[model samples]
Target chain A: MSSIDIAYIESDANPKVKRWKRLALEPRAVKRERATLLEGLHLLSVVLEHPKAEIAALILSEEAVSEAHELVEKLAERTGARVYGLTKRLYDQISPVENGAGCMCEMAIPAAAAPEDWREADVLYLDGVQDAGNVGTLIRTAVAAGFATIAANVGTASIWSPKVLRAGMGAHLAAHFVENLSPETFREHYRGRIYAADARGGRDLFAAPDYADGPCAWVMGAEGPGVSEAAIAVCDARYYIPIESSVESLNVGAAAAVCLFDARRRRLLKHG
Target chain B: MSSIDIAYIESDANPKVKRWKRLALEPRAVKRERATLLEGLHLLSVVLEHPKAEIAALILSEEAVSEAHELVEKLAERTGARVYGLTKRLYDQISPVENGAGCMCEMAIPAAAAPEDWREADVLYLDGVQDAGNVGTLIRTAVAAGFATIAANVGTASIWSPKVLRAGMGAHLAAHFVENLSPETFREHYRGRIYAADARGGRDLFAAPDYADGPCAWVMGAEGPGVSEAAIAVCDARYYIPIESSVESLNVGAAAAVCLFDARRRRLLKHG
Candidate 1:
């Protein structure tokens, strides 16, 4: 690789600093197609695997360069990204959440077509899942369990939010995001069975058709009030994740993991 | 049944308030043999399921009593415990955390015995998992997966922290806790083959030993930095939960669900 072009950002007012500030703090930066942010080397590796991920530039606190010596060298070799170093104070001002990891890269929103078969694959519809971390983790598990896509309701956290990006670890590149889903509209677009994961349910999870059998839709609600009654009433089934005698319910994030992987295991056994 | 002898608490400065305040913000409140706090009718239901859990006094906010009339009445009719109603404003002041469900009961912490045959079951060993929410959720999942007897290291969250209590959704009653374990100590007490849930050098979780055959313990670490190096060194084996193509890791709470359940499913098939 040619000698890396290094730039220094000494003030929060610097154009690069302002850009990263939104990347860290504002959800619209990612949602509005202005920019998306990825932090840490592991996540960057995930971006590299996505053939179309348009990584715009690398940004780091000066202290981060020393802390992430190997990563700095490697990003230069791999992405040909111009590394801009911000002073520690400037970095702190630009960080969106309290503990922003040392390394982040500004990326342009990739032009992606919605998966054509979103309605056919076993899928997850996030209805007002406000917590960024929960939304992200759900996407990651959905992917692991072989769900083809995620459809988000209007009030759900933006797919590009930093907390979600960090918690998701890096599922954004692999998973598809379809926004603006109301219960009535979503039902019309899909032909398969629909099940809402709610506490009060008609069946145990094991009783549901094995996920490998065919297309199914699994809907999860918000953390507090859970899926709206209108959504639950419309579902063909509501299955409970049979908790042990002592637990009232699993955390929504944990619940999704149990349900998603259960789907995956069923498929693996059927196919293998 | 005779009408219950209930007390009304209209004053904010009541001695009962002072007593619960200690349990509210303090971790030691539950550890000390004096008193513990339990909230919500769902939680109280979990407590009453165990005969050993002595119900001292029930605290219900007036607003909740009016709103959750059926639930409050059910709890009152079911137990010998006295119910006290406090006005909404006073209840807000006594609330341990923000926007609570408005039900708190003083109950006795039970003395739990280790399962006689933990060595033959799927198990989870938590090492210094400091976040109470994470710790509680882990225990809940371990129990949900049908594993018994989870122990915590000294550095981890107390098994009864309020955040964890809420997160576990009432799992503390069933889970067995062992305090302050070193790797050497864990080795001495547990006969199971220990598996460290590590990303590096770990076997694929989807292909691990069947949980039904013999003793197995899955050890998990704090967020960010995985398990401690010392703990990692003692693992008889290491295994990782497979994520999607780009995701690096799932949330620790979610990860526990995937691990515990995967092991449980394999074990179930083997035993059946």
Candidate 2:
């Protein structure tokens, strides 16, 4: 506690405060800084334990400084990051969620280089998925199901966006993510089976024979149009989750969970 | 179009406007009136197709009436539901979303009676899942996986709340829901096997032998504390999704999807 230095910020106009507000609200700021804001102590604690984490600052609401004083001191000491205590109003301005845990941090987004050959990578590919919650949930689900890499096309939402990060529930700290990818690039580099999540026509996912336990990519698309034409052009086949014929389709997040965990289940049954 | 009468309501203080506003914002009003509001044309279209649907009114923004006039007229005629054209400002007041389709309706809550015996039922029991989105996604996933019944414990978020309804994406119209059930009642009435979604420890879900294709229930709980004690008391077994050991847990919605869909997969494999 004695070693932790806490800077108290009273004004929204302070340079640090303004920059943080921008980082929280504006994607451009996050890109320029190569960092993003992670709200809540839960995310902060997860990031601190990641081997590659580089935390720039920890911001705590004035109330949190008192309510979570011991834990805050421990986190500050562990990361040796600068700590700022903000007025509740100022903190609220930087947090997108209403009535959130009054703690957040700015963490340097780890630069994960894509493998020169994606032929042997088990990947989750996002094609034009723009919902932050969906993208975040997919990341979390992919990690849970043992996907090591995630590649998103240019039009997908930023994986590090605040809302996505919140939805990710700390799984962001575990996976290697590559964004701004193109379908042409995916087709050229990935020499493995690629299965698009097709809603309209495909082999029934549960009844289909399992793909060999090797490198594969599960391509998921936006909710409306589903897997894009470009993405479909690269797929070895398309698979559709079986649902009630009257229901429209499974939500993308739910579909991903069903697909990925089924993949895991297959792997477990075969090996164990 | 000639068969439909579109009433224009401009005043926010009109008694009709006030009552509809209360219905949209207050759960008490919804329960009292025995109806809930469904926003967007997609939901309206689905409810119109259901045989039991009784729409009280269809409210549309001025913009939507023009943008979707033909479809609106077709829907109104199909259901013979009263239509009201609201100013964008007033329409936005009733719709919880931003930049929505601007079509909404108050539909009567369909009456569904509990089955005489749960021994032959496949159900999804939500045990104190307080997040509206999680509850909704669970409903959608369960319905997709062919679950016919949903029962939630008393402390779970209201299954029919606007947020939950919006998240359900029309699944609410497809399934029978029984909310505010006590675990004791569930234990007494339901003589089937119940599996709780446990994050901590349980049979590795994928490796566990399948339950026979008969009456069964999957119990899903809140994210933080997992399943409630009461819900656990009624569960014959606990199942946990396998994930990366470093990761904490899967989101409740994702967990439910994995569990329910796996159940579907087992059934498909057995029958096909």
Candidate 3:
């Protein structure tokens, strides 16, 4: 590793500390700067490994440098990004998690792909799934299920938000994220069978004939209102998970996993 | 309906307010009191509908009473439980959610079922799935998948904690809960085949044959140190949810959903 020239900041009012705090706390600030805060060793490693990830800066608390010296050095060397050390108090203020690893970085937001970019991808479209945890879990599930791309409509939670990133558990680095698209734009540009997951009044998910003939998009709706009527109208099919009648529905994240994995199961069956 | 006798308390120091706050905020307090605080209209309604639910008190914020007068009237009449009104300040202190529905109830924690109580029930054993959200989501998913009983082994999050209840949505009312069991105790009591969900090195879940012939128990492990070795040793079979090679595994809750729902589908197919 190259000699580390780490600048130390003890004041909370430092401009760099203020910027990092804003990026962690304020979605508007993240958007304005076109950068998001990546926290902890796991997420930072993901960013480092991602071919498209652009690192702006790395910030470490005094405690973090002492605890993870080798990791900090390697990360600093790999990105050739300026490294700053914060007083523990300032680090605590900027850390999104309680007793965080005290290491964080500013990284350029992964550019959202246009509809044309996903033409050959098996896409997962999130329609207003407002819970950040659900959104992140879906991103992770989508990658595990082998979906190549993810699109989030306008009403969906910001995919780059800190809470969503934490819930996503570094899945963001592995999948293509196309954010802030309207349902209409998604309908217009995507050339694939669109399957909307419904709680009721649809063909059974398992009973539906094989869908492995081509790439498809699974449109998951929000918790309560479900897929918006406008989004539903554009779907080629509606699939219902066969849940017992006593309950209203599965949590959106759980529902997404069932659907994505089931599709994968069908694909495996067809090709094997 | 009987005349609504709603009592009002302005002071946060009031005993009733203190008790309610304790129940909402502290799991130990909830256990000692043998009750839990239920928030929002939907969960309150579930408690009201449950045949065995015993209401100790129904607390409504001024905002909630005005916004949901009909619901308040119906609940007040149905339970004959004393209704208390809190000043917005005191209400905010006790409310578990952001923008809470303003109504809550203290309902008796249903007695934990003994091993004998689960004789013919399809059981879901949560083995150290410590995240409260995951625990609650698993409970809701288990119910929707028609699992009649849930057993949380020691190290699992409390099933009736506020976060779990919120995530559960109202699954707590519909399913039987068995808490604080050892892995050996669970094995000794459950009279069915036990299946542990593993990330790898197990039979494909979809290919598992004909479990609908009898009751079965699904053991879901924690997010990190998945199904404890002790717990796995007690299982009759281990099942793996197939996923893309690049990713590690599904979230515990999502994995539980896929497993429980797949069992439900098999049951339906068998009955048909």
Best-performing candidate as measured by TM-score: 2
Candidate 1 vs 2: which has more TM-score: 2
Q: Rate the local accuracy (lDDT) of all candidates.
A: 0.72, 0.83, 0.84
Candidate 3 lDDT, B81-141, residue by residue in tens = 8889887788888888877778888888888887678956899999988888899899999
Task: Give the per-residue lDDT of model 1 (tens digit) for A1-272.
Answer: 32556788786578777777777777877677557878776676676667577778877766674545456556766777788877878867655444545677788765433545576767888888898877888888787777858887788898777678777777878877677777787787777778888876666676456643677778899866888876786688777876665565667888788777777767666675
Docking class of 3: medium
Cα lDDT tens digits for candidate 1, B1-272? 22555588876588887677777678877677556777766676676576667778777776674434455555666666778877877767656555667777787666644545454556688888998877877888888777767776777887776667767777777767666667777777677788888765577777554543577788898877888888887778888876554555667787788877767666555563
* TM-score of candidate 1 chain A against the true chain A: 0.88
Judging by DockQ, tell me the better candidate of 2 and 3: 2
Residue range A71-94, candidate 3, lDDT tens digits: 667778887888888888988887
Candidate 2 vs. truth: CA RMSD? 1.8
Candidates in order: C-alpha RMSD to true structure: 5.1, 1.8, 2.1
Q: Rank the candidates by TM-score, best first.
A: 2, 3, 1
